[model samples]
Structure formats: structure tokens, C-alpha cells
Target: MLEALAQNLVYGILIGALYGLAAVGLSLVFGVTKFLNVSHGELLMLGGYASFWLFALWKVDPFISLPAAIIFLLVAGVVFYKLLFGRMVKLAEGDKIQNTLLVGFGLSLILQNLALQFWTADTRSITTAYSGAVFSFAGVRFPLVRVASLVIAFVLIVALQLFLRRTYTGKALRATVENWEAATLMGIDIQRVYLLSFVMGAALAGVAGALVAVGYSIEPAMGMSWTLKSLVVMVLGGLGSITGTFVGGIILGVTESATGFFLSLTYREVVGLVLFLLVLVFRPQGLFGVKEG
Candidate 1:
């Protein structure tokens, strides 16, 4: 029992880091653009497919293909915002939110169906030569790929944090997020900020997707579920708080691990929903979320 508990803890931490990365992307978009991106998971799906095709066809390593995936998704995100979300940004706040949600949902459905047509609903995975390599200490064994993914996630998160804190454009982004009108009056290019935010968010999702592809099976319909999960993580982390998102992901990872260990795999999702509901009821602002004006 003790050994099992130890194993689950390690698993939870590793998986939770990936969850944090995914949720951070959503939170970043929401924080800056106030767009509830329902199509975010599809970006992950695209990343998975990109990595898979690169590995299967060209024999490129998934890690090696990550930069290309990031760039592709970043460009795609900028185009999406410019073509779709940009037009609605001038609407009344409530109307803009509603429209963005609807548009995102429609985009998600379209992407999912397109993927189904192309990938045929069949599940796929990327299995490199060292995919099954493991590290063992005491009675615990950890997959090397998962460990690598966790490390990459942390590195990316730290890089993102630094970018948001130290760079000129990053400061401009924060200013825009705080008050677009004031930022515009101060000569900050609001359109550029929005484009950068959306692109960064999409790129983060792409990286997380690549990591996930290395460890899990990929399928056309796999994105929606991850989308929902990432949303839960976003809300739990308090909407726009990066630190909160990370903590929320860890909490979720631990909770899911405990549930799966004690009960059945089927009930693990239910517990996440329950946690989300409880947070909504007790603290709608989120665990670490601030009440933004």
C-alpha cells in the first residue's frame, strides 16, 4: 500500500505539471483577451498530429519537431484571432464573451470533424526507440518520457513567466491586459498585444500537446475531453492567475491519482468535476484567483 501510494504521488506530480502547462495557456488567453477559447484543445490535437506525422514519416524526434509545431500553432493562432476574434473585440463586453464562446465552439466542432475525416477516428501514438525507457529507485519506476515532459513543462513555464515579467513586449501585454483603453492612450498597440497573447497561448498548448503525444494515445476526438479538463484547471486556478493554475493542476493531479488508486478509473473524472463544483460554490474567484476589476 505504501509503495503504491508513493508511485501514485510521483505520477500525479508529473501529470499535474503538464496539466498546469495546458491550463496556463488558457489562463493567459483569458487574462489578456478575455476570450473563452473553446477551440484550444484542438490546438493540442493538431500538435499531436504534427508530432506523429513528423516521427512516422520523416523519423524526426518529437522533441525535435516541437519547435516547428510551436511555430505553426503560433502563426495559426495569430491568424485565428485576426480573422475571427478581432472583429468581435469591439462588441459590448457580455456580447463579445458570448460571441467568442460560440465562435470557439463552432471552430472546435469543425476541427474535430476534420480530424476525424483525416485520421479516421483511429488512435495513434508515437513510440520512439527509447519511449519505454524507465528510471527506477527503490520500489518505484518512472517512465523517462514522462519525466522529460515534466522537465520541459517546468522550463517552459519559467520561460513564460520571465517573458511576462522582464521583456518590453511582455510588459506591454500586461499593461494591455490591465486596461486596453489606457494602454492604447499610452501608445501601446493593442492589436499587436492581442495577437501576441493569442499566439503565445496557442504555442504553449502546442508544446503541451507534443508532450502528451509522447506519453498517451492520440485520437481525433481526444481534444474535446482535454479541452474540458484544461478549462477546469483554468477555473480552479482562478481564471487568470498563472501560479493559481499551476497549483490547481497539481491539486487535480493528486486528486485524480488518489481516486484512481482507491476506486476505479471511471470515477476519476467524476472527482474532478466535484472538485470544480465545490470550488465554484465556495470560492468562485478560485483557489488563488484575485478579484480583478
Candidate 2:
């Protein structure tokens, strides 16, 4: 049982890093813009699919394709901003949420089905030389690719933390997160912040997609699962807190591992929902989120 627990924990943490990557971006978009991007997962799927096609046809490695993926998502984000988000802001935040949710969810369905139509819903994975190597420690075996992806996720979280703490535009995003009304009053272009933040968030999702393509099955409808998981992370971590997202993700990871070990694999996913409720019941503000910072 102990050995099985260890293995589950290992899988959970590595998987949680990817979940953190998903949630952090989703949380940021919600924090500043106050819109829950329901279709955020589809972008992740798009990222994976983007790399898959490029790797298949152009012989490009996804690690190398990361930049192109980021750029593509960034452009896609900006286009969405210009075509959709910018217009929605004229409506109230509540209206924006309703409109964006409808539009984004619609887009997600379209993307998922379209992917099935084009790709045939087959599970696809990248077969790089490093794909099959596993590192064993004590009694468990850890795949190198999963480890690499976890490292990338952690690095991204830290780098984004540093960016938010040190840079000008990052500061603007923080300011916007803190108090949108005051930031608008203090000469910060909330609109620009919204555009940039949304774009950056989308870019983060793109990177996650690339990483996932390295290790997991790629499909059109996979985004819904991820999007739901990210929502749990965001709520548990506190919607506007980057650090909170990390804490929430790690907690969910450990909880999932524990549950999956002792209980049935059938209940593995239920752990996230349970944790979400447990956190909200105890600390509605989230693990690391500040109520009125």
C-alpha cells in the first residue's frame, strides 16, 4: 500500500504541475478581467494539435515548436480580444461574462468537434527520443518526459511570479488585479491590461498543450476535462492569486494521489471536486489568496 501510495503521489504531483499551469492562467484572466473563460481548455487542445501537425509534417520537435505555439496562441488571443472581448467590455461585467461564456463555450464545442472531424479522435503522442526514458528512485519509476514537463510548469509559475513582482506591465496587471477601479483612475489602461493579460494567459495555455502532447493522448474534447480541473484549482486557490493557485494545485495533487491510492481509480477525479468544496467551506478566500490586498 505504501509503495502504491508513493507511485500515485508521484503521478499526482507531476500531473498537478500541469494543472497549475492551466489554472494560473485561468485565474489571472478572472482576477483582472472578471470573466470566467469557459473555453480556455480548447486553447490548450489547440496548442497540442498545433504541435502534433507541425511535428508530423515539418519534423519539428514540440520543445522547439513552443515558440511558434505561443506566438500562434498570442495572435489568436489578440484576435479574440479585438473581435470579441473588447466589444463585451462595453456591457457590464456580468453581461461580459454571459456573452464571453456563450461565445467561448460555443467556440470550444466547435473546435472539439472539428478536431474529431479532422483528426478522427485518435489518441496521438509525440515520439521524441526522450519519450520512453524513465528514472527510478527507490521503488518507483518516474518518466523523464513527465519530470521535464513538471519542471517546465514550475519554472513558468516562478518566472511569472517574478514578472508580476518586478516588471512594469506585470505591475500593471497586479494593480489591475488588486483594484480595477483604482487602477483605471490612476492612469493605468485597464483595457490594455485586459488585452495583454488575456493574451499572456492564452500563451501559457499553449505551452501547456505542447507539454501535454509530449506525454498524454491528444484529442479535441480533452479541453473540457482540463477546463473543469482548472476551475477547481482557480476556486480553491483564490481566483486572483497566482501563489494561491500553486498552493491549491499542490493540495489537490496530494489529495488526488491519496484518494486514488486508498479508494478506487473511479473516484480519482472526484477528489478535485471534493477539495474544491472543502476549501470553499473552510476558507472561501482560497489557500493563499488575500481577501482585500
Candidate 3:
């Protein structure tokens, strides 16, 4: 029983890393731009497809094809922001959130339909020669693909943290998140920061998608679920702290895993929602978020 529990815990941490990675993208965009891009999961879906095609056509390794996915999403982000989201950049906070939410919802529908039209509604996953390889330690099994994914996710999150803390542009982004008006007055280009944050968020989602394609499965209708997961982690981790948000993802993953193990697999999904509701009611600022004055 202990061994089985340990195995389940390992699996939970592995998937939780992905949850963190996906949520980070959404959190970053919302934190910096205050634009809740509801279409985040669709962007993630496209990323999975991008990696899938790269592998399907040229037999590219999913890990090796990660750059392609990132590039694809970055370009998509640019187009999305310039053509659609950019128009609402100057709106008041309330209007910006509302308009962007509606727009993002519409965009998600369009993307989902386009995917279904082009790719069909079938589920897809990447199965490499070594996909089944696993190592056991003290009676617990750890899948290599999932372990690699966790490493990659952690590295990316750390890289993002460093970029935000150490780079000039990243500092500008932080300043904007704190106060866009002040950032603008300080000669930071608000539009550019928004564009960069949105693009980066899309890229992160792409990475998460590619990982999912290799480790799990992808379909046209998977966007909403993933988006909700990200939202849950974002809220749990708090608003502005990347580290906190990543930890939140891990917590949700572990909770779901435990719930599935002790209760039933059917209860796994409900755990997140329950936690989300509890958090909202008791601590709207989130576990790591600062309470606004």
C-alpha cells in the first residue's frame, strides 16, 4: 500500500509540473497585462498539434520539436495581439477584462472548430520508442518521459523567473505589472510590454502542450479543461508570484492524485473545483497573492 501510494505521488508530481507550466503562462499574461486570455488553452492545443505534425511528418522527437512549437505559438501570439487583443489595450481595467474575456472565448471557439475541421476530432498522442521506459526505485515506478517533462517544466519556470528578475525588459514588464501608468512615465513602452507578455504566455502554453502531446493526449475539445486547470492553479498560487503559482499547480496535482487514490478516480476532478471554491471564499487574494489595499 505504501509503495502504491508512493507511485501515485510520483505520478502526481510529474503531472503537477505540467499544471504549473501551463498556469504560469496564463498567470503571466493576466499579471502583466490584466488581460485574461481565455483562449490560452486553445493556444496550448495548437502547440500540441504543432509538435504532433512535426513528429508525424518528419519524425521529430517531441523534445527536439519544442523549439518549433514555441516559435509557432510566438508568431501566433503576435498575430493575435496585433490583430485582436491590441485594440483593447488602452481600455479601463474593467472593460479590458470583460472585452478580452469575450474575445478570448470567441477565439477559442474559432480555433477549436478550425482544429476539428483540419485535424478531425480524434485524440492524438506521441508514442516514441522509449515512451514506455521506466525506472523503479524502492518499489515505485517513475516514467522517464514524465520525469523529463518535470525537469523541463522546472527549468523553464526557473528561466522565466530569472529573466523577469535579471533582464531590463523583464524588469520593465514587472514595473508594468505594478503600475502601467508609472511604467509608461518611466519611458517603458506599455504596448511593447503587453505584446511581449502575451507572446511569452503563448510560448509557455505551447511548451506545456508539446509536453502533453508526448506524455498524455490531445484533442480539439481539450482546451476548456486545460484552461480551467490553469485558472485553478493561478488562483491557488495567487496572482503575481510565479513561484507561488507553480507550487499551486503541484498542490492541485497532488490533491487530485490523493483523492483518486483514497476515494475514487471519479473524485479527482471534483477536488480541484472544491479547492477553488474554498480558496475563493476564504482567501480571494490567493495563497501567495498580496491583499490589495
**How well does each candidate superpose onto the true structure, as a TM-score?**
0.96, 0.95, 0.98
The best-first sequence of candidates by lDDT reads 3, 1, 2
C-alpha RMSD of each candidate structure in angstroms: 1.3, 1.4, 0.9
lDDT by residue (90-164, candidate 1, tens digit) is 888799889999999998898899999987898899999999999998899899999999888888888888888
| lDDT top scorer | 3
| Residue-level lDDT tens digits of model 3 in 1-293 | 99989989988999999999999999999999999999999999999999999999999999999999999999999999999999999899999999999999999999999999999999999999999999999999989999999999999999999999999999999999999999999999999999999999999999999999999999999999899999999999999899999999999999999999999999999999999999999999999889865
The ten-residue window of minimal lDDT in model 2 covers 84-93
Per-residue lDDT of 118-183 in model 2, one digit per residue for the tens? 998898889888889998998888999889888888888999999999998899998898788899
Off by over 4 Å in 2: none
Highest TM-score model number: 3
In TM-score terms, candidate 1 sits at: 0.96
